[model samples]
Target: MSFTLEFFATPEIPEVLKECLRVLKKDGRLCVVAMNQKDDPTLMIKLYEWAHRKFPTFVDCRPIFVRKTLEESCFPVLDSVEIFAWGLPIEVVLSKICKENSKRS
Candidate 1:
């Protein structure tokens, strides 16, 4: 399964990851591409922040945060890469459904 997550502003990431795992096949690989928030703020980042201020419910997505949530959901990350896209940093992670958990479900 593959998903491109707009981690730059998503709050329900943990719940989303859990749902993804639920539908994933046994031993299936899941790939996620998320915005990296570690770098200096770009125009997109500034705009996102502005929007967030207007909407307090907005989420500021971060790579480390999402990774932790994914692990908690029983999806162990197998590989990760950082790259630049459209002047924004992006994090790509490949994870797999844990054998034991997949079997249980």
Candidate 2:
């Protein structure tokens, strides 16, 4: 079996999953690593919140909703796990925010 990796950034996760399933071959495995909601107070979420406040629909990405989307896409999730995440210093997080803001502006 050939190996292909696809990464998508879509507001409609169900459509993305459907498209992935349609292209995947039989017996092929898919590894989906999505950052839906973080369990920790990470820089990513902080930046997202900052962006959201700046522009309300900014990066209006939707969560996968796990079970429902997978089932609908005809993909059975064999296993799932959650590892404890870490946090970053405020300066680094703020720097990232400034960079992102600059790019957008």
Best by TM-score: 1
- By summed lDDT, the worst window of 10 consecutive residues in model 2 runs over 89-98
Off by over 4 Å in 2: 1-11, 38-64, 87-105
Which residue pairs of candidate 2 clash? Answer: none
Task: Estimate, for each residue in 1-36, the C-alpha lDDT of model 2 and write its tens digit.
Answer: 011111234346557655655565545455554334
**Pairs with steric clashes in candidate 1:** none
How does each model score on TM-score?
Answer: 0.64, 0.45
Model 1 per-residue lDDT tens digits across residues 63-96:
3444655677788999988777555567787889
The model with the greatest lDDT is 1
Cα error, residue 51 of model 1, in Å, equals 5.9
CA lDDT, every prediction?
A: 0.66, 0.41
* Error at 98, model 1, angstroms: 2.2
